[model samples]
Target: MATFNVRPDIDAAVAKLSSTVGTKREIQHLPEVLWEGETVEMLATGVYGKGNGLLVMTNQRLVFYFHGVMSQKVEDFPYRSVSSVQWSGGMLMGTLTVFASGNKAEIKQVPKDQGKALADLLRQRISEATSAPTQAAPAAAPAGDIASRLATLDQLRAAGAITDEEYRDRRTKILDSL
Candidate 1:
Protein backbone atom coordinates (compact mmCIF):
# COMPACT_ATOMS: atom_id res chain seq x y z
CA MET A 1 0.00 0.00 0.00
CA ALA A 2 1.37 3.39 -0.95
CA THR A 3 0.61 6.34 1.23
CA PHE A 4 -0.51 9.35 -0.78
CA ASN A 5 -1.25 12.87 0.29
CA VAL A 6 -4.83 13.05 1.59
CA ARG A 7 -6.46 15.40 -0.87
CA PRO A 8 -8.29 18.48 0.38
CA ASP A 9 -11.49 17.05 -1.10
CA ILE A 10 -11.24 13.88 1.02
CA ASP A 11 -10.51 15.88 4.16
CA ALA A 12 -13.43 18.17 3.48
CA ALA A 13 -15.83 15.27 3.05
CA VAL A 14 -14.59 13.62 6.23
CA ALA A 15 -14.96 16.85 8.15
CA LYS A 16 -18.57 17.16 7.02
CA LEU A 17 -19.49 13.65 8.03
CA SER A 18 -17.72 13.56 11.40
CA SER A 19 -20.23 15.88 13.02
CA THR A 20 -23.31 14.17 11.56
CA VAL A 21 -22.41 10.50 11.87
CA GLY A 22 -23.43 8.36 14.82
CA THR A 23 -20.33 6.92 16.50
CA LYS A 24 -19.56 3.95 18.73
CA ARG A 25 -19.64 6.07 21.89
CA GLU A 26 -23.11 7.28 21.04
CA ILE A 27 -24.64 3.81 20.59
CA GLN A 28 -22.65 1.32 22.68
CA HIS A 29 -24.72 1.71 25.85
CA LEU A 30 -28.07 1.47 24.08
CA PRO A 31 -29.92 -1.52 25.53
CA GLU A 32 -31.48 -2.64 22.24
CA VAL A 33 -28.39 -2.29 20.05
CA LEU A 34 -27.67 -5.67 18.48
CA TRP A 35 -24.02 -5.29 17.54
CA GLU A 36 -23.13 -4.52 21.11
CA GLY A 37 -19.69 -3.77 22.57
CA GLU A 38 -18.48 -2.00 19.44
CA THR A 39 -15.98 0.87 19.55
CA VAL A 40 -14.45 2.76 16.65
CA GLU A 41 -10.89 1.75 15.92
CA MET A 42 -10.33 3.84 12.78
CA LEU A 43 -12.05 5.68 9.96
CA ALA A 44 -10.94 6.72 6.46
CA THR A 45 -12.31 8.94 3.74
CA GLY A 46 -13.10 7.62 0.25
CA VAL A 47 -13.97 9.00 -3.18
CA TYR A 48 -16.38 11.87 -3.51
CA GLY A 49 -19.70 12.71 -5.29
CA LYS A 50 -22.60 10.25 -5.11
CA GLY A 51 -19.98 7.53 -4.70
CA ASN A 52 -18.51 9.21 -1.62
CA GLY A 53 -18.01 6.75 1.20
CA LEU A 54 -16.46 6.23 4.63
CA LEU A 55 -14.65 3.16 5.84
CA VAL A 56 -15.02 2.63 9.55
CA MET A 57 -13.45 -0.20 11.50
CA THR A 58 -14.92 -1.02 14.90
CA ASN A 59 -14.01 -3.61 17.46
CA GLN A 60 -17.10 -5.63 16.53
CA ARG A 61 -17.72 -4.72 12.91
CA LEU A 62 -16.63 -3.11 9.63
CA VAL A 63 -18.89 -0.32 8.48
CA PHE A 64 -19.20 1.34 5.06
CA TYR A 65 -20.96 4.56 4.42
CA PHE A 66 -22.02 5.93 1.02
CA HIS A 67 -23.05 9.53 1.09
CA GLY A 68 -23.81 12.55 -1.06
CA VAL A 69 -24.93 16.01 -0.11
CA MET A 70 -28.52 14.83 -0.41
CA SER A 71 -28.54 11.26 0.91
CA GLN A 72 -26.54 8.59 2.72
CA LYS A 73 -26.38 4.81 3.12
CA VAL A 74 -24.67 2.78 5.79
CA GLU A 75 -23.83 -0.92 5.87
CA ASP A 76 -22.43 -2.95 8.74
CA PHE A 77 -20.84 -6.41 8.80
CA PRO A 78 -20.20 -7.80 12.25
CA TYR A 79 -16.83 -9.54 12.56
CA ARG A 80 -18.59 -12.74 13.55
CA SER A 81 -20.89 -12.54 10.57
CA VAL A 82 -18.09 -12.11 8.06
CA SER A 83 -16.97 -15.27 6.29
CA SER A 84 -14.04 -13.75 4.41
CA VAL A 85 -12.40 -10.43 3.66
CA GLN A 86 -10.11 -9.68 0.72
CA TRP A 87 -8.67 -6.73 -1.16
CA SER A 88 -6.87 -6.05 -4.44
CA GLY A 89 -5.60 -3.35 -6.85
CA GLY A 90 -2.66 -0.95 -6.67
CA MET A 91 -1.44 2.21 -4.93
CA LEU A 92 -3.86 4.56 -6.62
CA MET A 93 -7.16 2.69 -6.08
CA GLY A 94 -8.53 -0.70 -5.05
CA THR A 95 -11.51 -2.72 -3.95
CA LEU A 96 -12.40 -4.26 -0.61
CA THR A 97 -14.41 -7.44 -0.72
CA VAL A 98 -16.24 -8.85 2.25
CA PHE A 99 -18.32 -12.01 2.32
CA ALA A 100 -20.78 -12.04 5.19
CA SER A 101 -24.04 -13.75 6.06
CA GLY A 102 -23.96 -15.58 2.73
CA ASN A 103 -23.66 -12.35 0.75
CA LYS A 104 -20.80 -10.28 -0.59
CA ALA A 105 -20.13 -6.55 -0.51
CA GLU A 106 -17.37 -4.88 -2.48
CA ILE A 107 -16.24 -1.35 -1.82
CA LYS A 108 -14.68 -0.21 -5.04
CA GLN A 109 -12.28 2.55 -6.09
CA VAL A 110 -10.96 3.29 -2.61
CA PRO A 111 -7.40 4.59 -2.24
CA LYS A 112 -4.85 1.79 -1.82
CA ASP A 113 -3.51 2.73 1.60
CA GLN A 114 -6.96 3.27 3.00
CA GLY A 115 -8.20 -0.06 1.65
CA LYS A 116 -5.17 -1.96 2.94
CA ALA A 117 -5.34 -0.38 6.37
CA LEU A 118 -9.02 -1.15 6.57
CA ALA A 119 -8.33 -4.77 5.60
CA ASP A 120 -5.56 -5.18 8.17
CA LEU A 121 -7.63 -3.65 10.94
CA LEU A 122 -10.62 -5.80 9.99
CA ARG A 123 -8.52 -9.00 10.03
CA GLN A 124 -7.28 -8.20 13.52
CA ARG A 125 -10.77 -7.49 14.78
CA ILE A 126 -12.15 -10.65 13.18
CA SER A 127 -9.53 -12.79 14.86
CA GLU A 128 -10.34 -11.25 18.21
CA ALA A 129 -14.05 -11.63 17.64
CA THR A 130 -13.64 -15.30 16.74
CA SER A 131 -11.59 -16.11 19.83
CA ALA A 132 -13.68 -14.24 22.36
CA PRO A 133 -16.51 -15.92 24.23
CA THR A 134 -19.73 -15.33 22.37
CA GLN A 135 -22.37 -13.08 23.81
CA ALA A 136 -22.68 -14.25 27.44
CA ALA A 137 -25.19 -11.48 27.92
CA PRO A 138 -28.22 -13.74 27.95
CA ALA A 139 -26.82 -15.86 30.76
CA ALA A 140 -25.93 -12.97 33.07
CA ALA A 141 -28.49 -10.30 32.20
CA PRO A 142 -31.51 -11.59 34.07
CA ALA A 143 -29.61 -12.26 37.28
CA GLY A 144 -28.07 -8.80 37.27
CA ASP A 145 -31.37 -7.10 36.49
CA ILE A 146 -33.23 -9.00 39.16
CA ALA A 147 -30.62 -8.14 41.78
CA SER A 148 -30.82 -4.44 40.91
CA ARG A 149 -34.61 -4.47 41.05
CA LEU A 150 -34.53 -6.19 44.40
CA ALA A 151 -32.21 -3.53 45.74
CA THR A 152 -34.44 -0.77 44.45
CA LEU A 153 -37.47 -2.40 46.06
CA ASP A 154 -35.68 -2.65 49.37
CA GLN A 155 -34.77 1.03 49.17
CA LEU A 156 -38.36 2.02 48.41
CA ARG A 157 -39.65 0.00 51.35
CA ALA A 158 -37.11 1.53 53.74
CA ALA A 159 -37.97 5.02 52.57
CA GLY A 160 -41.69 4.43 53.19
CA ALA A 161 -42.42 5.04 49.52
CA ILE A 162 -44.15 1.68 49.41
CA THR A 163 -45.65 -0.57 52.11
CA ASP A 164 -43.90 -3.86 52.84
CA GLU A 165 -46.78 -5.71 51.24
CA GLU A 166 -46.48 -3.61 48.10
CA TYR A 167 -42.73 -4.05 48.01
CA ARG A 168 -43.06 -7.78 48.39
CA ASP A 169 -45.66 -7.90 45.62
CA ARG A 170 -43.48 -5.89 43.23
CA ARG A 171 -40.38 -7.90 44.08
CA THR A 172 -42.21 -11.17 43.48
CA LYS A 173 -43.55 -9.85 40.19
CA ILE A 174 -40.09 -8.80 39.07
CA LEU A 175 -38.64 -12.18 39.96
CA ASP A 176 -41.44 -14.02 38.24
CA SER A 177 -41.15 -11.96 35.11
CA LEU A 178 -37.52 -12.96 34.85
Candidate 2:
Protein backbone atom coordinates (compact mmCIF):
# COMPACT_ATOMS: atom_id res chain seq x y z
CA MET A 1 0.00 0.00 0.00
CA ALA A 2 1.06 3.59 -0.64
CA THR A 3 2.00 5.85 2.25
CA PHE A 4 2.11 9.61 2.75
CA ASN A 5 3.49 11.84 5.46
CA VAL A 6 0.56 13.83 6.79
CA ARG A 7 1.18 17.37 7.91
CA PRO A 8 1.34 17.75 11.68
CA ASP A 9 -1.61 20.13 11.78
CA ILE A 10 -3.78 17.86 9.67
CA ASP A 11 -2.88 14.93 11.89
CA ALA A 12 -3.80 16.92 14.97
CA ALA A 13 -7.08 18.00 13.41
CA VAL A 14 -7.93 14.40 12.62
CA ALA A 15 -7.21 13.40 16.19
CA LYS A 16 -9.39 16.19 17.54
CA LEU A 17 -12.20 15.19 15.21
CA SER A 18 -12.08 11.55 16.27
CA SER A 19 -12.28 12.48 19.92
CA THR A 20 -15.03 15.04 19.40
CA VAL A 21 -17.14 12.68 17.34
CA GLY A 22 -16.40 9.60 19.43
CA THR A 23 -15.51 7.41 16.47
CA LYS A 24 -12.30 5.85 15.25
CA ARG A 25 -10.70 7.87 12.45
CA GLU A 26 -8.73 6.47 9.55
CA ILE A 27 -6.02 8.34 7.61
CA GLN A 28 -4.25 7.57 4.37
CA HIS A 29 -1.58 8.98 2.09
CA LEU A 30 -1.33 7.85 -1.53
CA PRO A 31 1.88 7.87 -3.53
CA GLU A 32 2.10 8.84 -7.16
CA VAL A 33 1.33 6.01 -9.56
CA LEU A 34 3.31 5.27 -12.68
CA TRP A 35 1.71 4.93 -16.11
CA GLU A 36 3.74 4.17 -19.21
CA GLY A 37 6.88 5.20 -17.32
CA GLU A 38 5.32 8.53 -16.38
CA THR A 39 4.62 9.46 -12.79
CA VAL A 40 1.50 11.40 -11.79
CA GLU A 41 0.66 12.81 -8.40
CA MET A 42 -2.99 13.27 -7.58
CA LEU A 43 -3.93 13.86 -3.95
CA ALA A 44 -7.36 13.84 -2.36
CA THR A 45 -8.75 13.60 1.15
CA GLY A 46 -12.15 13.38 2.89
CA VAL A 47 -13.78 13.74 6.30
CA TYR A 48 -17.14 12.56 7.62
CA GLY A 49 -19.25 15.04 9.50
CA LYS A 50 -21.66 14.63 12.40
CA GLY A 51 -24.51 13.48 10.19
CA ASN A 52 -24.14 11.81 6.81
CA GLY A 53 -22.32 14.83 5.38
CA LEU A 54 -18.92 14.57 3.73
CA LEU A 55 -16.14 17.00 3.00
CA VAL A 56 -13.84 16.21 0.10
CA MET A 57 -10.74 18.08 -1.05
CA THR A 58 -8.48 17.40 -3.98
CA ASN A 59 -5.71 19.24 -5.69
CA GLN A 60 -8.25 20.99 -7.85
CA ARG A 61 -11.50 21.18 -5.90
CA LEU A 62 -13.25 21.29 -2.56
CA VAL A 63 -16.75 19.85 -2.25
CA PHE A 64 -19.13 19.55 0.71
CA TYR A 65 -22.46 17.83 0.84
CA PHE A 66 -24.83 16.04 3.18
CA HIS A 67 -27.17 13.34 1.86
CA GLY A 68 -27.05 14.94 -1.59
CA VAL A 69 -27.60 18.47 -0.34
CA MET A 70 -24.96 20.72 -1.83
CA SER A 71 -23.57 23.02 0.83
CA GLN A 72 -20.26 24.25 -0.60
CA LYS A 73 -18.25 24.16 -3.80
CA VAL A 74 -14.82 25.66 -4.32
CA GLU A 75 -12.53 25.19 -7.30
CA ASP A 76 -8.90 25.86 -8.20
CA PHE A 77 -7.60 25.89 -4.62
CA PRO A 78 -3.91 26.21 -5.66
CA TYR A 79 -2.94 22.79 -4.33
CA ARG A 80 0.65 23.93 -3.83
CA SER A 81 -0.16 26.59 -1.26
CA VAL A 82 -2.59 24.88 1.07
CA SER A 83 -0.90 24.65 4.47
CA SER A 84 -3.69 23.42 6.71
CA VAL A 85 -7.43 23.70 7.32
CA GLN A 86 -9.63 23.74 10.42
CA TRP A 87 -13.34 23.12 10.89
CA SER A 88 -16.03 24.67 13.03
CA GLY A 89 -19.83 24.78 12.67
CA GLY A 90 -19.94 27.97 10.58
CA MET A 91 -16.44 28.53 9.10
CA LEU A 92 -16.89 26.62 5.85
CA MET A 93 -20.31 27.20 4.27
CA GLY A 94 -19.18 28.85 1.04
CA THR A 95 -16.42 28.87 -1.53
CA LEU A 96 -12.83 29.84 -0.72
CA THR A 97 -10.16 31.01 -3.09
CA VAL A 98 -6.67 32.02 -2.10
CA PHE A 99 -5.11 34.78 -4.15
CA ALA A 100 -1.39 34.59 -4.71
CA SER A 101 -1.08 38.17 -5.89
CA GLY A 102 -1.93 39.58 -2.48
CA ASN A 103 -1.48 36.57 -0.18
CA LYS A 104 -5.13 36.69 0.90
CA ALA A 105 -7.90 34.17 1.28
CA GLU A 106 -11.34 34.94 -0.10
CA ILE A 107 -14.32 33.16 1.40
CA LYS A 108 -17.93 33.20 0.21
CA GLN A 109 -20.81 31.57 1.98
CA VAL A 110 -24.53 31.77 2.63
CA PRO A 111 -23.74 31.94 6.31
CA LYS A 112 -20.11 32.26 7.25
CA ASP A 113 -18.57 29.81 9.70
CA GLN A 114 -21.08 27.08 8.84
CA GLY A 115 -18.64 24.65 7.25
CA LYS A 116 -16.44 23.47 10.12
CA ALA A 117 -18.16 20.14 10.27
CA LEU A 118 -17.89 19.78 6.54
CA ALA A 119 -14.15 20.42 6.54
CA ASP A 120 -13.65 17.81 9.22
CA LEU A 121 -15.74 15.41 7.20
CA LEU A 122 -13.55 15.92 4.13
CA ARG A 123 -10.41 15.14 6.14
CA GLN A 124 -11.99 11.88 7.16
CA ARG A 125 -12.73 10.97 3.57
CA ILE A 126 -9.13 11.54 2.53
CA SER A 127 -8.04 9.31 5.36
CA GLU A 128 -10.29 6.46 4.23
CA ALA A 129 -9.38 6.72 0.53
CA THR A 130 -5.70 6.38 1.43
CA SER A 131 -6.11 3.47 3.80
CA ALA A 132 -4.08 0.32 3.04
CA PRO A 133 -5.62 -2.28 0.78
CA THR A 134 -6.37 -5.66 2.38
CA GLN A 135 -5.42 -7.85 -0.53
CA ALA A 136 -2.68 -10.52 -0.29
CA ALA A 137 0.78 -9.99 -1.68
CA PRO A 138 1.75 -11.51 -5.00
CA ALA A 139 3.77 -14.72 -4.98
CA ALA A 140 7.57 -14.52 -5.27
CA ALA A 141 9.43 -15.32 -8.48
CA PRO A 142 10.45 -18.96 -8.99
CA ALA A 143 14.01 -20.25 -9.43
CA GLY A 144 16.07 -19.02 -12.38
CA ASP A 145 15.10 -20.53 -15.73
CA ILE A 146 13.74 -19.38 -19.06
CA ALA A 147 10.26 -18.93 -17.57
CA SER A 148 11.62 -17.24 -14.46
CA ARG A 149 13.83 -14.89 -16.43
CA LEU A 150 10.99 -13.98 -18.73
CA ALA A 151 8.71 -13.36 -15.78
CA THR A 152 11.33 -11.29 -14.00
CA LEU A 153 11.92 -9.27 -17.13
CA ASP A 154 8.22 -8.63 -17.45
CA GLN A 155 7.97 -7.55 -13.84
CA LEU A 156 10.95 -5.22 -14.23
CA ARG A 157 9.44 -3.70 -17.33
CA ALA A 158 6.14 -3.22 -15.62
CA ALA A 159 7.90 -1.46 -12.72
CA GLY A 160 9.83 0.83 -15.16
CA ALA A 161 13.13 -0.80 -14.23
CA ILE A 162 14.28 -0.86 -17.87
CA THR A 163 13.40 0.94 -21.04
CA ASP A 164 11.52 -0.89 -23.75
CA GLU A 165 14.56 -1.02 -25.96
CA GLU A 166 16.75 -2.33 -23.11
CA TYR A 167 14.13 -4.91 -22.17
CA ARG A 168 13.87 -6.16 -25.77
CA ASP A 169 17.66 -6.38 -26.08
CA ARG A 170 18.03 -8.31 -22.80
CA ARG A 171 15.14 -10.61 -23.69
CA THR A 172 16.72 -11.44 -27.05
CA LYS A 173 20.09 -12.13 -25.40
CA ILE A 174 18.48 -14.38 -22.77
CA LEU A 175 16.62 -16.41 -25.36
CA ASP A 176 19.70 -16.72 -27.62
CA SER A 177 22.00 -17.74 -24.74
CA LEU A 178 19.47 -20.40 -23.62
Candidate 3:
Protein backbone atom coordinates (compact mmCIF):
# COMPACT_ATOMS: atom_id res chain seq x y z
CA MET A 1 0.00 0.00 0.00
CA ALA A 2 1.23 3.46 -0.92
CA THR A 3 1.00 6.23 1.65
CA PHE A 4 0.86 10.00 1.21
CA ASN A 5 2.89 12.38 3.27
CA VAL A 6 2.36 16.14 3.71
CA ARG A 7 5.15 18.66 3.96
CA PRO A 8 5.46 20.79 7.07
CA ASP A 9 4.27 24.08 5.57
CA ILE A 10 1.37 22.49 3.71
CA ASP A 11 0.48 20.55 6.81
CA ALA A 12 0.24 23.80 8.73
CA ALA A 13 -1.90 25.35 6.00
CA VAL A 14 -4.19 22.34 6.00
CA ALA A 15 -4.48 22.53 9.74
CA LYS A 16 -5.41 26.19 9.60
CA LEU A 17 -7.98 25.52 6.89
CA SER A 18 -9.51 22.72 8.90
CA SER A 19 -9.62 24.74 12.09
CA THR A 20 -12.97 26.38 11.41
CA VAL A 21 -15.09 23.32 10.65
CA GLY A 22 -12.65 20.52 11.54
CA THR A 23 -12.12 17.41 9.42
CA LYS A 24 -12.66 13.67 9.58
CA ARG A 25 -9.19 13.01 8.20
CA GLU A 26 -6.07 14.87 7.14
CA ILE A 27 -6.43 16.49 3.73
CA GLN A 28 -2.85 16.46 2.49
CA HIS A 29 -3.66 16.35 -1.19
CA LEU A 30 -5.43 19.72 -1.33
CA PRO A 31 -2.44 22.03 -1.80
CA GLU A 32 -1.13 19.85 -4.59
CA VAL A 33 -4.30 20.35 -6.64
CA LEU A 34 -4.78 24.11 -6.39
CA TRP A 35 -4.21 26.27 -9.44
CA GLU A 36 -1.22 28.61 -9.48
CA GLY A 37 -3.19 31.75 -8.64
CA GLU A 38 -5.80 30.13 -6.43
CA THR A 39 -6.19 31.02 -2.78
CA VAL A 40 -8.21 29.26 -0.14
CA GLU A 41 -11.09 31.35 1.15
CA MET A 42 -13.12 28.97 3.28
CA LEU A 43 -13.47 25.27 4.13
CA ALA A 44 -16.18 23.19 5.74
CA THR A 45 -16.79 19.55 6.54
CA GLY A 46 -19.62 17.87 4.71
CA VAL A 47 -20.97 14.71 3.14
CA TYR A 48 -21.60 14.30 -0.58
CA GLY A 49 -23.50 11.10 -1.20
CA LYS A 50 -21.80 8.41 0.89
CA GLY A 51 -18.45 10.21 0.88
CA ASN A 52 -17.48 12.46 3.76
CA GLY A 53 -14.98 15.16 2.90
CA LEU A 54 -14.03 18.80 2.88
CA LEU A 55 -15.87 21.46 0.90
CA VAL A 56 -13.33 24.11 0.00
CA MET A 57 -13.84 27.54 -1.47
CA THR A 58 -10.99 29.14 -3.32
CA ASN A 59 -10.50 32.34 -5.27
CA GLN A 60 -11.21 30.50 -8.50
CA ARG A 61 -13.35 27.47 -7.64
CA LEU A 62 -15.33 25.37 -5.21
CA VAL A 63 -13.54 22.06 -4.49
CA PHE A 64 -14.79 18.93 -2.77
CA TYR A 65 -12.26 16.27 -1.83
CA PHE A 66 -12.88 12.91 -0.25
CA HIS A 67 -10.11 10.51 0.69
CA GLY A 68 -11.41 6.99 0.92
CA VAL A 69 -9.66 3.79 1.91
CA MET A 70 -8.88 2.52 -1.56
CA SER A 71 -9.44 5.65 -3.63
CA GLN A 72 -10.05 9.38 -3.56
CA LYS A 73 -12.55 11.76 -5.13
CA VAL A 74 -12.22 15.37 -6.19
CA GLU A 75 -14.69 17.71 -7.81
CA ASP A 76 -14.23 21.36 -8.64
CA PHE A 77 -16.76 23.94 -9.82
CA PRO A 78 -15.17 27.03 -11.29
CA TYR A 79 -16.77 30.42 -10.72
CA ARG A 80 -17.55 30.83 -14.40
CA SER A 81 -19.26 27.45 -14.53
CA VAL A 82 -21.36 27.98 -11.42
CA SER A 83 -24.90 29.24 -11.97
CA SER A 84 -25.99 29.70 -8.37
CA VAL A 85 -25.47 28.60 -4.77
CA GLN A 86 -27.97 27.96 -2.01
CA TRP A 87 -27.63 27.43 1.72
CA SER A 88 -30.02 26.16 4.36
CA GLY A 89 -28.91 26.29 7.95
CA GLY A 90 -30.34 24.51 10.92
CA MET A 91 -29.33 25.25 14.53
CA LEU A 92 -25.75 24.03 14.10
CA MET A 93 -25.31 22.67 10.60
CA GLY A 94 -26.28 23.58 7.05
CA THR A 95 -26.56 22.19 3.58
CA LEU A 96 -24.89 23.90 0.63
CA THR A 97 -26.09 23.21 -2.86
CA VAL A 98 -24.24 24.40 -5.95
CA PHE A 99 -25.85 24.54 -9.35
CA ALA A 100 -23.38 24.36 -12.19
CA SER A 101 -22.55 22.75 -15.52
CA GLY A 102 -26.02 21.28 -16.07
CA ASN A 103 -25.91 19.55 -12.73
CA LYS A 104 -26.29 20.17 -9.03
CA ALA A 105 -24.04 19.19 -6.10
CA GLU A 106 -25.42 19.07 -2.61
CA ILE A 107 -23.20 18.90 0.46
CA LYS A 108 -24.77 18.35 3.85
CA GLN A 109 -23.53 18.68 7.47
CA VAL A 110 -21.54 21.84 6.87
CA PRO A 111 -21.02 24.21 9.76
CA LYS A 112 -23.83 26.73 9.75
CA ASP A 113 -21.77 29.92 9.84
CA GLN A 114 -19.10 28.77 7.42
CA GLY A 115 -21.62 27.31 5.02
CA LYS A 116 -23.71 30.49 4.98
CA ALA A 117 -20.67 32.67 4.39
CA LEU A 118 -19.38 30.37 1.65
CA ALA A 119 -22.78 30.30 -0.07
CA ASP A 120 -23.08 34.09 -0.04
CA LEU A 121 -19.58 34.56 -1.35
CA LEU A 122 -20.07 31.96 -4.06
CA ARG A 123 -23.31 33.66 -5.16
CA GLN A 124 -21.61 37.03 -5.37
CA ARG A 125 -18.72 35.62 -7.40
CA ILE A 126 -21.09 33.79 -9.71
CA SER A 127 -23.07 36.99 -10.24
CA GLU A 128 -19.95 38.94 -11.04
CA ALA A 129 -18.59 36.30 -13.39
CA THR A 130 -21.90 35.93 -15.24
CA SER A 131 -22.49 39.69 -15.57
CA ALA A 132 -18.98 40.95 -16.28
CA PRO A 133 -18.96 40.39 -20.02
CA THR A 134 -22.15 42.34 -20.72
CA GLN A 135 -21.53 45.19 -18.30
CA ALA A 136 -20.00 48.41 -19.53
CA ALA A 137 -16.53 49.29 -18.39
CA PRO A 138 -16.57 50.69 -14.88
CA ALA A 139 -16.75 54.44 -14.50
CA ALA A 140 -13.55 56.16 -13.53
CA ALA A 141 -12.88 56.35 -9.84
CA PRO A 142 -11.69 59.45 -8.01
CA ALA A 143 -7.91 59.90 -8.15
CA GLY A 144 -7.32 58.68 -4.58
CA ASP A 145 -9.71 55.81 -4.91
CA ILE A 146 -8.12 54.70 -8.14
CA ALA A 147 -4.70 54.71 -6.52
CA SER A 148 -5.96 52.56 -3.66
CA ARG A 149 -7.68 50.12 -5.99
CA LEU A 150 -4.65 49.85 -8.20
CA ALA A 151 -2.44 49.16 -5.20
CA THR A 152 -4.80 46.50 -3.93
CA LEU A 153 -5.00 44.88 -7.35
CA ASP A 154 -1.24 44.87 -7.65
CA GLN A 155 -0.95 43.23 -4.25
CA LEU A 156 -3.45 40.58 -5.21
CA ARG A 157 -1.47 39.73 -8.33
CA ALA A 158 1.77 39.67 -6.46
CA ALA A 159 0.37 37.37 -3.83
CA GLY A 160 -0.99 35.01 -6.51
CA ALA A 161 -4.56 35.66 -5.48
CA ILE A 162 -5.33 36.70 -9.07
CA THR A 163 -3.85 35.36 -12.28
CA ASP A 164 -1.70 37.33 -14.72
CA GLU A 165 -4.51 37.62 -17.25
CA GLU A 166 -6.83 38.94 -14.57
CA TYR A 167 -4.17 41.43 -13.48
CA ARG A 168 -3.63 42.64 -17.02
CA ASP A 169 -7.34 42.98 -17.76
CA ARG A 170 -8.02 44.89 -14.58
CA ARG A 171 -4.93 47.04 -15.02
CA THR A 172 -5.98 47.94 -18.54
CA LYS A 173 -9.46 48.86 -17.38
CA ILE A 174 -8.08 51.03 -14.60
CA LEU A 175 -5.59 52.75 -16.92
CA ASP A 176 -8.20 53.29 -19.61
CA SER A 177 -10.34 55.20 -17.13
CA LEU A 178 -7.56 57.77 -16.67
Cα lDDT, all candidates: 0.61, 0.39, 0.74
Any residue pairs clashing in model 3, and if so which? none
lDDT of 1: 0.61
Tens-place lDDT per residue, model 1, 147-171, is: 9878998886675445556667888
Q: What does candidate 2's lDDT look like per residue over 1-178, in tens digits?
A: 2222454433433443322221122232211111132222222222333333223344333433333233422222333233334433344344433332123343434223324444454455444543547654235433466677788988867754454666798799667655
Better of 1 and 3 by lDDT: 3
Candidates arranged by TM-score, highest first: 3, 1, 2
lDDT of candidate 3 at residue 6, scale 0 to 100: 50
Between candidates 1 and 3, the TM-score winner: 3
TM-score of 2: 0.23
Q: Against the true structure, what is each candidate's TM-score?
A: 0.51, 0.23, 0.63
- Number of backbone-clashing residue pairs for each candidate, in the order shown: 0, 19, 0
Candidate 1 residue-pair clash tally? 0
Show the lowest summed lDDT stretch of 10 residues, model 2.
26-35
TM-score winner between 2 and 3, please give it: 3
How displaced is residue 153 in candidate 3, in Å? 32
lDDT of 2 at 29: 22
What would the TM-score be for candidate 3 when compared with the true structure?
A: 0.63
